[model samples]
Target: MSHSAIRRVPASVQSLRSRAVWLLLALVLAVAADAPSAASQAQAPATADDLKQVQQMIDKGHTDEALKRLDELAVTQPVVPGVHRLQGQAYYAANRFSDADSAFAAALVQDPHDLESTQMRGLTLFRMGKPAEAIPLLTAAHNWGPQTRVDPSYVLALCYLDTRRYDDARHSFALQYGFPPDSASSYLLAARMLFRRDFVPVAKDFAEKALALDPQLPLVHQLLGEIALAGNHLDEAIAEFEKERARNPLDGAVYDRLGDAYSRAGNYQPALESLQRAVLLEPYNSAPYILLGKVLLRQQVPANAAMYLEHAVGMDPGNYMAHSLLGQAYRSLGRTSDASRETQTAEKLQADTEPKLQNVK
Candidate 1:
């Protein structure tokens, strides 16, 4: 990060909190003597030794053994919050998100204010594809430590990013570090926000930084490709998107970027191929279909274009671009009545939106 970049305390504090959680857990074990057993030998209370052993196993990359210890510890200390907390952390490290969620929930019920447990629970929820549930928990965890820290805020920012709350993500990221985010996440979100505001140079710079940090980052590649496309750097955009596809074969947006780049480069055949792949990857998303239609329309394949546009409208009735392009395709095919209807629909859809086309023609 550049020295001139804006730095804020909240984001820094959040990062510090995340580091402190691990350190505190270690200190908690070292300084705090093990409590006496709360059960018989068959079901003994978990001592600091149990937690330390689990931690050691985890450090050694023996997640299964650590989790097994957590299971035994749980049997003896079912009501002890740390038992569930350890299980949660173990499951999370293993990428067993659903199991981690259940473990975290059990821990939260016993120790509601346990910052580490709460943060882990939030991350587990995020990994479970429940960003909405993760956001508030992460926000609360961020407040557990001093405001000058950064880790908690970083977590909160990521939750916002996952939920597509770009403005909130930007604000959270801005709190700790300025313009270019220190992490790949902060850079990606900042780039998008800057792009949305038409700050092209600044956005491109951050996007490049994001890719430099984590070349496989999805949004970073997408945005960088977009900026390159805007500058008529079609080959550059294709290269960026190709790198993204290599990293994430299932990413629909990468194909969409490829399609856009190919189309602008006047490679209609390749454009169609890429957009078709995008739609195949994300059949429910209407944007790729609309773009596909536009490409076919440019090729003078009105019938094929109309079919895709109709599909796009079916997927997203409110999509003005789809409606407008469908109208154009209908007009090109001499389907006057259909053209008029689609044009009217498009007009209505555009009534409250800008960059408005008065007619499809």
Candidate 2:
């Protein structure tokens, strides 16, 4: 709980962070990118260091201080290159979207080739819910020189999706990820992306479209089932997962998801069967092992549950769910000391991973 504690992230959470940061670095950290170099280019020698310090301030969450320093810089050179961009960043970090948009616009006006300014202007507009107004700038800046740290095409696709430009959205998304825009796989990719972004209803439509184009497309039914499962439509999820099973019998993931759906529906026997199949098919993953342990625990077979859980914990030591379930199994078996240790480990793992998981925002 201490602020200065040495933080450690679980491997699972690290994977999530890497995925989220790609999208996030574009939307948030893009403004803060390469500040030292940007400052070194075209400025009074004194102002160069000043800009660096101000950017450091902004990066440290001291936006107010950064803005005040930028104000002093403005007084020295009202037209100083990169000053407005820094101001825009400070405003952005401070949640002053309108001010950020104006500052980035001023930076663009001063130097039309300021790719950072152009990209930030578009992003600020998007943050302000002006997706339509953001398209042109985002489109132009997505491929600008001194290329952005992450593709701006990600947001451009979202903007297109928001404005009901499905074709454009799909095209931009495919371009960002190198998928063929007209293929069934493209729509499937869009649906997966949209599903993760919480555009679930729209995601379902795309998934359906993918199926329409190619009924036997791999994972399309699985994606549909995943959407239904997320929406808590258990029967629908089971139906879709069954359809997926019919199409791709060798996919261990389908069995894993089907087992999860069955477990959630309290059909423990089938859940056990499906999870056991998943365990055989996906030997490298610990998910089915953990789920199998839970099903055993639910059936009051603590000894068996403990065996599976121990295997799961060994496979993924940082998995708090596995640790917590192992604690339950130990408690049921009256291994008081062992139960207490696992409970403590589960708590520690959960606490350690919470902050990293929050980084998804």
Candidate 3:
């Protein structure tokens, strides 16, 4: 389920890209003096040695020293094609995000096609909380080919997530993870992302594709279970969840989900047992507690329901469902004032979350 780790290309491909850097460096040097300014024309161009020294400093974790050298170079070689790019690299290494952004901007101004500068600038903008600006730049850099180090595709996926472009985020993540076209993992990942955006039908198709490829794939059954639960297909959801539980008995989330499915099917005793197991497995999670309270209430055990509901609300005060269930318990116990208060809080939380849920969908 965790897709954050980016897969690296083969070492030979990386070696080839490394060799191409020299050619890129040469091209940058050839255009160093192309700036149409008297100051740039008066100054000597930065030598390959100068660029190499800064790179070596950065490589050695001497970003401060690299920045100092870059500052000196900027004074005399203000418009040098690759100097700002190197400066940006050093600044980024030092975690000076805004400074890095400015340096990369200068590098892009010098050479619009500078891939390294564009990628660095996009990453810098992302770090500075400007994902909208970062996306296009990252997309452009990713299109330049053979992304070895600092994968632009991974960063672009993150940018898409930040901007709430779920489909783009899923596609970018699949690409960055190096999933093959018909890979089971790719389909599963797509299903998960689509499910988050509430694209149920498409998500179900991808999930089914993953199952067709490998029936025993971890989390695939769980995903299908969740989709069925969302659609109120209680029997199908319970079956899928049971399949997932057989594969991963230790996963508290599966137990919690199974409990929900059983509860929706009006199988309270099994639901209670499953929910209690979920709570035992993940004591810190409020979800099982909330479900346990609701099931207890359904069985007309308000006293026990109130205890679980109180624990759930204590753990996650902002949970509207938990608050609402606690209110029902309070009403059953004839605590009118407490029930009124809980109902008001639940109403407010529901109103607040509805817009966010709508936006996500």
Candidate 4:
């Protein structure tokens, strides 16, 4: 998926708490401990035997036991350079984020230039919903050198994305992927990053380069479709989405985009079919439901529109567009009180978001 597609929190749903939830989920999937092995701890001036033992326990997947041993060592050797670092690794492996964060912090105090501790601490802070604190540590780790294993650059890119540092995120992701500019994947990734930053013209240039390099690249057509949609070139968007569908028929996001394009092009029947397919493919996503409601309303099927809009609102109550559309549907169905309530809610949401929208530029 494109970074723009993933990171584009709906304007109506732009709350830090909500964005943090999504970011934390991404961090959990991406971040890993940059733990050094026993033989690789040459620079550490700590008790080598204890470090070696901790690494053995971690390697054997006995994280709990490793934590217990680290705790024992900490009571006697609290200022040991690598001790807390190893403890952080064990705690991270055990999914104890708070403990891991503190351990990493302690390790950094003892040895400020410890790259593994720095990266692990940054990753821990990110997982703990502290992206601002993670940024400097991650940047330092990234600047240190190439990571042999468990690169922290991806997590760092995500931190930049979460913090709305678009240019930094783009650079970090490019570094993480390490693809030459001529590579199709590199072009596509650059396109997605630029798209997220609202640099649509530049994004289109990169997308075109990706297409020129490999027309059959998995998401290149989808990126083009998104660009076309952004420009309100409905027919062009539909054509690109159709090409994507031909290549990846089972992708729910493609169906959702195609359905949206069809609806905008006044092809209601096809829009309904495409959206229904999207719902079947990814039932949890609310976009298809919202689009289905919209198409139904356009088709003068207010009753059906109300049903789908209700589902959309149920799934994502913060979606102001869905609320507004549902209000229209309810008014058409002669549900005056319900329509009034939904309309008022939508208006309030729009008013609340107006300031943020104005500040976007």
For each candidate, what is the lDDT?
0.80, 0.89, 0.88, 0.85
Query: What is the TM-score (0 to 1) of candidate 1?
Result: 0.49
Residue pairs in collision within model 4: none
Model 1, CA-based lDDT: 0.80
Instruction: Please say which candidate is ahead in TM-score: 1 or 2.
Output: 2
Candidate number achieving the greatest TM-score relative to the actual structure: 2
Question: What TM-score, over all chains together, does every model reach?
Answer: 0.49, 0.69, 0.60, 0.56
Report the CA-based lDDT of candidate 3 relative to the real structure.
0.88
TM-score of 3: 0.60
TM-score, ranked from best to worst: 2, 3, 4, 1
lDDT ranking, high to low: 2, 3, 4, 1
What's the count of clashing pairs in each model shown? 16, 0, 0, 0
Q: Which stretches of model 4 miss by more than 4 angstroms? A: 1-140, 143-172, 178-182, 356-361
TM-score of 2: 0.69
Q: Candidate 2 regions off by >4 Å?
A: 1-72, 89-99, 128-133, 161-168, 231-235, 246-250, 267-270, 280-284, 314-320, 340-361
Question: Positional deviation of 122 in candidate 2, in angstroms?
Answer: 1.9
Per-residue accuracy of model 2 over 116-176 as CA lDDT, tens digit each:
8898888889889999999999999886356354468888888988887877888888888
**lDDT of each residue in 1-361, candidate 1, tens digit only:** 7655656457888999999999999888765544333335657677887788887787677889898877777776455457887787778778888888998888888888778878877777876778889888888876545322237666676677667676677677776465443678777777886777667887788788878898766767777888888888889999877877887788888898899888888889988998999999998889889989999999999999999999999989998889899999999999999999999999998986767556521
Q: Which stretch of 10 consecutive residues in model 2 shows the poorest summed lDDT?
A: 38-47
Pairs of colliding residues, candidate 3: none
